[model samples]
Target: MSEQSADPAADLSDDVRLPKEQPTPAFFESKTFRLISLVLYLGGISGLGMVLALYYLIFFDSGMPDIHLKFPVSIGGQPVQKVHEYQ
Candidate 1:
């Protein structure tokens, strides 16, 4: 059997870096994490946009290029003004 040096540092390579304990994950795991992060970031931005828009619409004025369906078709159809005949 070959004799090893009594000193622990003697076993180390020339670089002499500390051995990493944790196992490194694959590259795809990192990419998946990044994609999930991006989606959450964009979702938060869109949610904020919707809240501000509605707040402005409520407290402020209207006429913002017709969101549509403000009023549905009346069941009675065309509106007719009642004529008052008082003699």
Candidate 2:
């Protein structure tokens, strides 16, 4: 007699049976999060590269020659002045 509806329990049951969870297509699955993660990852990688570069430049790539320098070198079978030349 009220709006000619004989069954209203069907609509009520649909709403009550579902849990209050996040939607399937949510913000976590959006492109914004992916972009931010990529940016942070690249930044960390670049930072590590910079640190390694500085370390190598300071310790490994020193300006030292492979050969040694001998002082008071000899020339023409005679001892010359104290000169440092690579041996």
Strongest candidate by TM-score: 2
**Can you list the residue pairs that collide in candidate 1?**
none
Off by over 4 Å in 1: 5-10, 13-29, 61-87
Where does candidate 2 stray beyond 4 Å? 1-24, 61-87
TM-score of each: 0.40, 0.41
lDDT of 1 at 24: 72
Task: Write the residue-wise lDDT of candidate 2 on 13-86 in tens digits.
Answer: 45443455645567678899889899999999999999999999888867876443554457797776644555
Output the lDDT of residue 84, model 2. 59
Residue clash pairs of candidate 2:
none
Residue-level lDDT for 38 in candidate 1: 91
Model 1 Cα lDDT, one tens digit per residue, 4-52:
8999887878664456955676766788888988999999999999999
